[model samples]
Target chain A: MPGINTSSLPDIIFMLLFFFMVSTTMREVTVRVKQRMPEATEVQKLEKKSLVSFIYIGEPKNTKLFGTKSRIQLNDVFASVDDIPEFIAKEREARDEADRKFITTSLKVDGNTKMGIVTDVKQELRKSGAFKINYSTRKKVERRSR
Target chain B: MARRAAPEINAGSTADIAFLLLIFFLVTTTMDVDTGITRKLPPPVENPDEDVDVKERNVLKILVNSHDMLMVDGKRSDVRLLKDKTKDFMALHPDNPDYPEITTKFIEELGKEFPASKGVISLKNDRGTSYEMYIKVQNELARAFNEMKDERSVELFGVKYSQLVDENKIKAINKLVPVRISEAEPEDIGGK
Candidate 1:
């Protein structure tokens, strides 16, 4: 009889809802680069555990450029074109030896960086003797107004 | 027909469930962030057209290990020598129709070397390389190439800088130079 009592049902329902709501948390995906990226309407989902290489260019800590601390992010530097293939081979070997069946290598470039750097990264990755390479991207999630 | 007036069930309970589901998705899903460098890839084909002839011998291959070390044609060199040595190589391959930028005679001449010698740069960036350094390299190459294109337009075609790049032409310019990057598999490369 006590269990079946219906008078306090509304309070029980409210308490259950509150408990469920407080218990849930959001998940986060951490990418390598720390910068504001340019967004694309179309995004490609990359393979999991694949190879993704990041380049950063900025002033070394405590260095002054033009009398002011010249802060250049990693995206500003250039990778020698000649070194690309060997780099790819090394990457391939490392991935294969680790027992990974499939690998996708990607580059996370800077927005302020010039187009040449992006091109060099791509050129090197392709010629690295690896057959397939993936460029990393993020999907545009619709923002909900608070 | 004695009667059956079925009681009307409340619809409000269903609304409560829907509200809970909406809130759950709102809290659990990740927020999207902005990214740079939109790379439009070649169509995925069941079998791609095999890359023919075009001697791979002259192609200078640079390898970046996961440690970010620079390796050129299997030989190690200081980073400072990269641009100068690339320029020298371009000079050797004169009149190679594939890479027009090679004739520029400047550090920018390296971009021509990439495409002309059927140049293939193989980046073997390690998994641990920071994203910041990766992009910095990419941007530097882009700037170098753009300078080459600008110089070539002025030297070879006598086109003014204004004609080369304009507000209306900027979008098209982005398509002119295609950066070729390939990621090699760990297994095929011997897993070093």
Candidate 2:
């Protein structure tokens, strides 16, 4: 039997490797809370990922340690409602002075969570002067007419 | 001694190296694009106790309880009917005194006078209400305004509001059918 050349196999694999490398975005934080977002029909795509700060609200993954109550997460740590202003301030300071106005605070709250926690977070955000807010939600694909 | 070509190094392991890196990236790749409902928060009021008077007839009250029950204008209603109800309430109905009052203003972009509805949707939910119900209500309210805008856009520009690309045309359409949903602070109306 004649041997078929396998030299091009490396080139093809290298091409795929480069494609994956270019497309991949590393997960920024260790999500310590369960985050099943709510679904909505009128969702807008969040532009400029770098300019968006995320606030997660859900039951903690380690329920035994953190208790069953929902908690707020800023970056990788469990945070309280009071920590929100400081977090927003830190996020603004990290960016360029001109880009501060464009920063959007994205709230990723679990659907099962109560509105009280989310409202508290919103009020804190408002007080911090971060008026631009995005309620992170999944897109509802099937549209049902009434 | 005759010059000799260097022996070719074996490239057999190159594929394995590439495969390793590709696997790493594939595992790390999160293809999920972040999407959400964008909203602008009303600036924090210095005097929160102060009240702004809006005509009682001009505001549509929607209340959601902890059990996810909806109340529109003090009448229990289904979520499915919210869009149409809002549309009817906001549509220009000069003969109907129960509906919002219409004010005529000349739009610079359209170069004509248009009667704009002064209707505002006031949504209040209990603190114990689920986030899912809140989003559903928000979605319905947005749909109501969007459908009205689409209708007006079709009438004037022969296109859907979302399909219109011209900035001036969009401005005119927005002026004709503005979205005015005001969410109030959640109260402990429904005991958890």
Candidate 3:
């Protein structure tokens, strides 16, 4: 029996590689907090990723250093509520003048976290003039009733 | 002289190179789409003490205690019943003084006057309330508003609200059934 040709294997591999590269996005910030986002039925896909800045809220992975309290994360570092305005300003400055108005702050708060910290973050965001915000949540699938 | 055929380039290592790059991308990237409940925060008030004089009947107050118990319009209610309750509250019940008063306004996009509910959902939660419960309450309120919009869209355009792609039609629907959920500052209710 003649050996089967395997010349198309490289092309197939390259196709898969290209698909992954196009569909996936690079993880921008290293998440120091343990974030388990809450589930919700009413969710809209965040459009224009460039215009979205993320704020992570959850207990730190290293409990020894950061304590048990929920900490706010802006970019790669753990930040307090006071740092949010500066973070917003920095984010705004990074973008073009036209795109500055379109910036949205996405809050990825852990489900188990208390509302007090979240509210504080929200108040800080309000003072900073970041009116548009999104609560990052996983899509909850509902079971059909008979 | 007969032209010699060019040698075929070796392609066996291409698969290895592709595999290496694919692994790199797989390690560095994430496939999950960022989805969430979008909201607009009201601008910071100049005078925090000054209260807006909204009529008593127009506001539907929803409170979530630290224990995750729900209180809707001063009545203890289940989370499952919230959507239906909100829908009923916002419905055009002109004769019912308990329900929100309706104001008919001329919508430019629709080119017809429609009754818009003056109802506003006020959500207040305790400082110790879990984020999960807050999101659940928010989801229910959003669902109620979405259903109202869908109902109106079907009656006017013969299609579901999500199915309507026209910008003006969407704007008209939004104007007809506005999502007026006002979240209040977290209080230290029900103790820490």
Candidate 4:
């Protein structure tokens, strides 16, 4: 018996692999801040990927490099509150006019973080009219029944 | 047709090219999934000094200090009991002749005050308060509204709040007990 030709094996695997790549979103940034999200029972899954921008707040992941300070991360850059409006404006411009109204700012903050920076971030977002804010959290784990 | 056999095309190189591209994308693809709790921030007021006065009776004040302790309506409260207390405060059918959800019999049973239409939840926290505690309180308040909406949904439409697809039905449920959370500016307890 002759051996079967398997020349198209890689092609078959690539097609499936490509589908997975295209179907899922790529991680856009490396988080330099350490974040442990809080848990909430009323969590909602954000439906649209396009209309959301992320803001990460926590202590520096490399505590030695940034001195264990809580920092604000917008995209790949560490930013101050002054940069928030410009960031949101840029984000808004990337969206279609019709979809702009639905744009959301997702806040991923460490549970142990103080509210000082979070409050400032919220104020800046409000000034930018990025009123749709999502607090990233985990679903409440059921520990007991009534 | 034996003399016209189709020319054999090579597919060997195509596999290598695909393999390279596949590896690139496979490594770049992110498996991290993100989900969250969404809140709409009220548009900022022009003047911080200009404010409307709310009756003390119609407001439930929740203060989270630096210690992550909860003060609900001036009383110290456990994080766990926040939900039930919020639910009790949000109870609509506690015997109001006007709302009818608060039937006299219902009020007689539960012994709750007549639910107020103009009730507001004022959430204030010290800057030193942990985000964890803040989020938990928010979750409880949101759950209070959600549970009411869900209960009303079941009574009216025999479905869960999320399953009520009609916009009008949703509006009606919301009108029953409008979500009126007022988050106050945090006090600078972090000393920043």
Q: Write the per-residue lDDT of candidate 3 for residues B25-97, one digit (tens) a residue.
A: 7787777889999999999989978999899899999998888999998999999999999999999998789
Which stretches of model 4 miss by more than 4 angstroms? A1-11, B1-7, B12-16, B93-116, B189-192
Correct interface contacts retained, every candidate: 0.07, 0.89, 0.85, 0.77
Give me the runs in candidate 3 sitting further than 4 Å from their true place.
B1-8, B186-191
Clashing pairs in 4: B93-B101, B93-B102, B94-B102, B95-B102
Calculate candidate 4's fnat: 0.77
Higher-ranked by DockQ: 1 or 2: 2
TM-score of chain B of each: 0.47, 0.90, 0.92, 0.78
Q: Could you arrange the candidates by DockQ from highest to lowest?
A: 2, 3, 4, 1
DockQ, every prediction: 0.06, 0.81, 0.80, 0.68
In TM-score terms, candidate 4 sits at 0.86
User: Which candidate, 1 or 3, has the higher DockQ?
Assistant: 3
Categorize the docking of model 4.
medium
lDDT of 4 by residue, B1-192 (tens): 458877888877877888777788877777655777788898888988887776675677899988889999889999788878777765654444322233222233223333435567889998888899899899888888888789878976799889988887776666665687898854565464
Better of 3 and 4 by lDDT: 3
True contacts kept of 3: 0.85
Ranking by TM-score: 3, 2, 4, 1
Q: Which runs of model 1 end up more than 4 angstroms from their true locations?
A: A1-146, B1-38, B42-54, B84-92, B95-117, B157-192
- Model 4 alpha-carbon miss at residue A46, Å: 1.3
Docking band of candidate 3: medium
DockQ leader = 2
Error of 1 at B32 (Å): 16
